[model samples]
Target: MPPSRQPGFENTRSNEYWFCFSSPNVESHLIISISENHYLALAKGPLVEDHVLIVPVEHMPSTLSLSSEFEVELCQFQNSLQRYCKSQGKEVIFLEWVFIRATHANLQAIPIPSSKAVIVEKAFNLASQKMGFKFVSKNFDSISDGRKFLKTQADEESSLSYAEISGGIILLHHVEEKVRFLAQFGCEVGI
Candidate 1:
């Protein structure tokens, strides 16, 4: 049987409730691994092969809202994915889109051929420019450092998107309240 749902919550639209990641009833088979506070799972309807998600077990609104402990675990997961992809002669890109009304936070990990890895940043930059937004970029020695930087920039209410490309480059774009964002922007530009 599936998890029980409250009445009038069919749309599953709020940050307060109805999270797919937190529900074991549906995606149990999709989970690849679980850490102390998070889970690594194969992304549903992945845009490409080996696409996965790193998600917090508890319903967190966004990565920016993650606690320091969660951040450490998240980084560990990222590093593991990076190493795995590297071993397979691929490069990994991690994309996190934190919407204003985001329910469960998830970071999408995408693996691409090493040959095409060079264009990841350029493609994202071009997309940003065309969409009338600018990405503020910074290079970190590790994903942990990058997460710390992102936390410093986040407050109670922040809507943003960021991509952590292989080799420790982080490109961040703050999403304005009035502007519309493509939920599949990362998938569209990644491939």
Candidate 2:
């Protein structure tokens, strides 16, 4: 039998549903910046004020499956967002839900007050307990190191979700293909 279909992409092979980034007619105000491989845009139905998304220009399933050139540009956009948020007394937490057949890979950048940053890890830990999963935690000295670790931990065949927290720490949970997953898990945890 063929592999099981990912929930949202069974009948779709295009990025039309995620139109804010893919649409040529995207609202100028919703877009923050565009780069060679990605676009930083305000998210639709944001979970918090100033929530944004970093999406690839090309249709792809996961950032981990992309090239280093793509990773470099993505890191640049991430850094820019972090800087902007920091200037506003906030820090960013970047999240991604990688699946076997997602229509497009996008990173959700959520800004929280720097004062509340300490509680983020604790919240995720509690959430994991309630959600019946464990997050394998790791620390990195830079974005490249964190990204590299994630790349090695999962691939196109693996379903996982991760949060690139401020200060070079990342928490990743490998989602068993057989288990029911909350696609918005990272966002829910953040909220």
Candidate 3:
């Protein structure tokens, strides 16, 4: 079953509410929505444009504890967004993370050029440094160990597949670098 709706809320539009937040580092703007009891937003991060964050509306410590329904909704929303991006002629890069200390679970999606693999790699390295988390580069065969690493973190244990972590970081860095690149195109990132 879906989580109960928060009290004192009227059905304004389609079972969800969207709110836009002011972002300092992004000029394109950040628009957020509370839909189906989850937090959904569009953000223009540093490395890529049209970045989106999809999170649980209620405070949840980690992805490991998310209800099955929330997981389904998240996946459905992600797929729909990816389709939308594809229709726009941009490839969507999906990223998900369970930060031990953060109260909410997060998933980020960024649009990037198909040929920027090297730049994506560099961005991953930079994200590792900024977040103070070790970045491990590995292939599919080494994913089990990676899951173990996340499982041992102090605050909570959440498993992350190698593909998930690698792809997630790449998307993050791509968004982080978007603003600087946008300048060359004569567009300013307002926030």
Query: CA lDDT, every prediction?
Result: 0.79, 0.82, 0.44
My TM-score estimates for the predictions, one after another, are: 0.86, 0.88, 0.49
**For model 3, what is the alpha-carbon lDDT of residue 37?**
58
Residues 1-191, candidate 2: write the lDDT tens digits: 11324554533455254533554555557777888888888888998899999888776677887799999999888888899999999999999998875766789999999998888888988998998988888989988889998899876566899999987989999987789999898888854
lDDT of candidate 1 over 1-191, digit per residue (tens): 11113343433544233225534344567788988888888888887789999888876767778888888888888889999999999999999887766657788999999998888889999888888888898999978888888888765455788899977899988877678898778778745
Ranking of all candidate structures by their TM-score, best first: 2, 1, 3
Residue-pair clashes per candidate, as listed?
0, 0, 16
Indicate which candidate wins on TM-score: 2
Which pairs of residues collide in model 1?
none
Which wins on TM-score, candidate 1 or candidate 3?
1
Q: For candidate 1, what is the TM-score? A: 0.86
